[model samples]
Target chain A: MTKKQLKNLALQSYTKDLLDQKKVESVARLLTRFQLKQYIRELRNSESQKTINIVLPHLPAKTDQQMLSRLFAGKRIIYHVDKTLLLGIKIIDNDQVYDLNLKDTLDNLFTFVSSGYD
Target chain B: MIDSQKIIEQLENRLMSFGVDKKTQNMGVVEKITDGVVIASGLSKCFMGEIVAFGNGNYGTVLNLDEDTVSIILLGKEGKLKEGDGIKRTGKLLSIDVADTILGRVIDPLGSPLDARPKIKGARAMPLERIAAGVVEREPVNTPLKTGLKAIDAIIPIGRGQRELIIGDRGLGKTAIAIDTIINQRVSNDVICVYVAIGQKQSTIAQIIDRLKEEQALPYTVVVVASSSDPASLQYLAPYAGCAIAEYFMEKGKDALVIYDDLTKHAWAYRQLSLVLRRPAGREAYPGDIFYLHSRLLERAVKLNKKHKGGSITALPIIETQANDISAYIPTNVISITDGQIYLEPDLFYSGIRPAVNVGRSVSRVGGAAQTSAIKSVSGKLRLELAQYRELAVFAQFGSELDATTMALLERGKRTTEILKQLQYQPLKESLQILSIWSVTNGFLDDIPVESTQRFEKEYHEFVSSRNPKLLETLETGEKPSEPTVTQMEKITREFKKIFSF
Candidate 1:
């Protein structure tokens, strides 16, 4: 197919996802692996009540959990521990991720310094 | 060779300057990787043109922002980027640090030194893509940006803010003209030069740098190289990066000249990036924005008005045409964008015209405004005379009978062409250029054999300088020679011819 036709196909798939939210999960299952990921991400951004995943190098305190629950009020939270983060937390909400980590900070600092601070 | 110790020290100082804050980064997961473009999801907060870091320690610029994913064009290697790999937005656009320290350095598009020298400690960062200066910020181009070649300086005069294209077929001395212009800038300290070598062979770039060094032009020059071996992203970014470096100087009330030693490769690199991103292709499979790509870049070379400090960025962009076809896509786009063009011809090159500039096709839109009074006085009618001679000479090639006027015109044109023949890398001073043109136009070389004109010019310059130093000074002042100075010059020329037998 020509590029334009392929682009139209992709557009149609996303349009279908937007038009019928309940059919998204079923249509996503029938899609290829890449297409399914894209479809699910698009569907998640279409509305609220997202399934948010929180990963941290260590367990959060009770106070931190209370704050997190309040921040994502309408969403369902899934928790996991990932040691690679070194410290701090990664919150994944479908197409949006918020990373507050020492690893990312240090990496950014190194890139900033190496690239010359102007 | 980065001075890691110095960089570490500076980093410590920078760290001390930073105040602690809650750091948050928008993250993405790599969905697919193909041909230096990464399709990633979870970066819904990522804005267009933001710099993103891949899990593999690579960095890329976000190009396409979609409903589901962001398409990033990698600035570095894509070797280890995999599906499910994480990416983070830095919330910054692509920029390069530029400073006076960058002068005399060979740098990549990222402003990193490639010559194994110390890392540049720049005071300012210039973003790669910038809006062109508005019309209110500009002034008319009045001063000449001399290339020091008689053919160009006399006829196709380039102004301080002009965008003059050097165009021809491959290997037809386009780079030679640009290099000569750079070397000629060594005569003046006011204008700094930036040479951007895009997609050229490394060996060729090395040779050019070595030539700049040999000419002592490297001291005030910056060489930005994105060789053929580099990824298309860097090659595409090279010219804009070079322009950014030049703008640093131009905005500081200093004159700057920038040469993109052929943008055809730059266009090719951009085409590759666009195709990889799957953008719709236009004619020749190039993206529709191809014309906009060059227009924006060329428009930035402008002369700011007196209120804006009167600094200028003169661009001499070279474009390689196939079979001398200026009608081709890239060549025509550049030609229409530039103020004028110096069109070199293969036939003229083979015929031993070093610059090989086809005067018929070549023109300076700046006209006589860019020329010094000394040169303008002598070259006022030179272009018309040469054009007429060319037309008559073509008819004369049929072996038909010709009038005396036609014969004289042809002979004068031959001597004029011969006098304009300059040696490679040996750019003449304005004084010498005027003297040479003055000698020919004043009919001093009419009786001299055409073959001996070069020798006569050399001897005449030496004699005049030794006998009447004030004449050269007058020419160098850029003023029209007084009637007495002209009379003295004529008298000296007649005496010199009499004293020496040819």
Candidate 2:
């Protein structure tokens, strides 16, 4: 089947609030192995679009968590601690990164200074 | 000397205004490394020619963008990138850092010093791939960019902002002509020069650098080297980087000349990049845009109007052809793109004619407009005499007997050939070139034996220089010769001819 048709099939397998397990199983059995892999990837992409990933140097306290949760209401918020950031938060929405980290700031300053003074 | 106090104040102001804010970067993860090309996905916002920062001072320029991925040829020696390394967009195009201080230094395509000198200081960045000055910004090429070679100045003249190709087979003094032209600038015009050496051996480039230094021409010149050992990405960008540096000076209202010493290797570098990127290869395994690669670079050679800065960039792009084939793909492409070509022949070169310029084939589409009035006044007769000689010499080779008129034409042709034959690195002054050509074309040199023609020329030059300095001073003013000046030249020739011993 064409990829567009398979995409429609995968879309129909989902119910109003969540995916229907039996409907997904029935559509999965109709797809070939390659198409099944592509369908799963598409579903993963669509589901990830519902959340924002906030990467930081360490876990946030309750007040900051509540503020972030309130800021991005209805979407799932995942927190990841990457110590390379040193401090501050990075909000990754799809392919774009909203970088407010100490590393980027230092890098930006270094780039500016070197480009000017060097 | 740096303005340390002023820089400190500027730094203080920057620190005071500095604030931590969120900046956006559209990034991607490297999917694979194929023949030094990084295949990446998800930099959907990336533009062609944008720099992708791989962190730690390593970078790549975006060369290809497809529906799913982009391909970038890694630029420098730091190529230990992993498959999952994330590369971020710098939002900056590829550019070269240029300053007036960059003169006399040898730098790479990235504008990094390779001459063991300090980096460029307080420079402005000029984009390597700039949209050429449009029609409205350009004026017609009028002023001369003299090569100082008699054959070139008299025949295939190059003007400020003109694109003149120097094409020939190997070992035929192609680089010699370019070096001579660069060296000539030190004598007149004070034109700033940039020489881009792409895919040349280091030793060859070193010798050229030494030669330029020996002649004291290096002070007014910048050498941009993307030698054979460097990555193809650097080689591909070398000519553009050189052009950008020259453009930097031109923007400051200074005249500049850039020589791409053989662009054939540049085409090979682009083809290598394309094949590695998996772009569909077209003619002769070259990518479809092969013509555009040179066309775009050469199109940037322009003479800007006064409404803008009246600066200009004259391009002398050399192409080394195989076996003297001018009909080859790259040769034809550049020949059409340039205003004209100086067609050097292997036949003439091996026949002991140094700077073996074939005048019958070499043409300046910009023509006498770029020639000084002094040279233009006498070059016409020299051309006819040479053309007649060239045709008659072929017949004489058949060993047929000829009449007096033909014999006279043959004699004049031989003398003219001898006069045009200049050795390596000895470009003549403009008025001197005119004087030599006028004497030969006016039948003053007809009685001088072909064997002694060169010696006769030497004495004639010394006789004038040691005696009639005012005559040369007048010709140097670029006026067409007046009646009295012509009579004086004729009188001097007659006097010298009588006093001379064969």
TM-scores, all candidates, are: 0.90, 0.90
Model 1's chain B TM-score? Answer: 0.96
Model 2 residue runs over 4 Å out of place are A1-51, A61-76, A82-87, A110-118, B1-22
What is every candidate's C-alpha DockQ against the true complex, given to 2 decimals?
0.36, 0.50
Q: Give the runs in model 1 whose Cα sits over 4 Å from its true position.
A: A1-49, A56-67, A82-89, A99-118, B1-12, B20-22
- Candidate 2, residues B157-270, lDDT tens digits: the string is 899999999999989998999999999998884699999999999999999999999989999999999999998889999999999999999888889999998799999999
lDDT (Cα, tens digit) per residue for candidate 1, span B173-290: 8899999999998887789999999999999999999999999999999999999999899999999999999899999999999999879999999999999899999999999999
B318: Cα error in model 2, Å: 1.1
Question: What lDDT does each candidate get?
Answer: 0.86, 0.89
Leading candidate by lDDT:
2
| DockQ, cand. 1 | 0.36
Recovered fraction of real interface contacts per model = 0.52, 0.71
Q: How many angstroms is residue A34 displaced in model 1 relative to the true structure, after the best TM-score fit?
A: 8.5
lDDT by residue (A28-116, candidate 1, tens digit) is: 56667766654555444443225678999988889988899999886667789989899888887765566688786786677666555
